[model samples]
Target: VEVSGLPPNLNRSCCDCGVYALKYIESHMLNLPLDLINEDNIREARLKLAVDLWAASKDPVLIDRMEKYEPHNNSSDIVDVS
Candidate 1:
């Protein structure tokens, strides 16, 4: 698939390919028609649908790194690594 609108810095490597594939599958699966999926065949249908949609859709952007500008904790206390 040829995914567009991806960040220019997005990572594309074999190490992260599976992660990208799963994300793509999840996104597509959410929009699947309810009538096309049922309890008895949901498993198979989900896999098939995901594959088909992924094949037809564009390539996904796989992020390998991101810059964090702020601290996650509100406490000012610091821990000594030593």
Candidate 2:
């Protein structure tokens, strides 16, 4: 697996496609039972994705933002601040 290639010290690698796959998975996870996506679930999924992105970037700002993620009640797309 591609994840097995990176050294322990360099755990972050920009696998662009992998990132997209994560996005897709997040979307799927957020989809609702009535075929109407739940905004809260989507917001949670987005936060998780942002955390993953922050880990891959090794950027302090992103990392800090990851911890401060707030789930908004309005819309799922709005929570995707990453």
Clashing pairs in 2: none
Worst 10 residues of 1 by lDDT: 59-68
In model 1, pairs of residues that clash are 1-59, 2-59, 3-58, 3-59
Off by over 4 Å in 1: 1-4, 12-14, 31-82
Please list the Cα RMSD from the true structure of every candidate, rounded to 1 decimal place.
16.0, 18.4
**TM-score of every model versus the real structure:** 0.25, 0.28
lDDT of 1 by residue, 1-82 (tens): 6343534433333344444445556656686433332234445544775787776555343222223245576877887989
Would you list the C-alpha lDDT of every candidate in the order shown?
0.48, 0.51
- lDDT assessment of candidate 2: 0.51
Q: Write the per-residue lDDT of candidate 2 for residues 25-78, one digit (tens) a residue.
A: 554666523223233344555567789766778978877897999977785464
Clashes of 2: 0
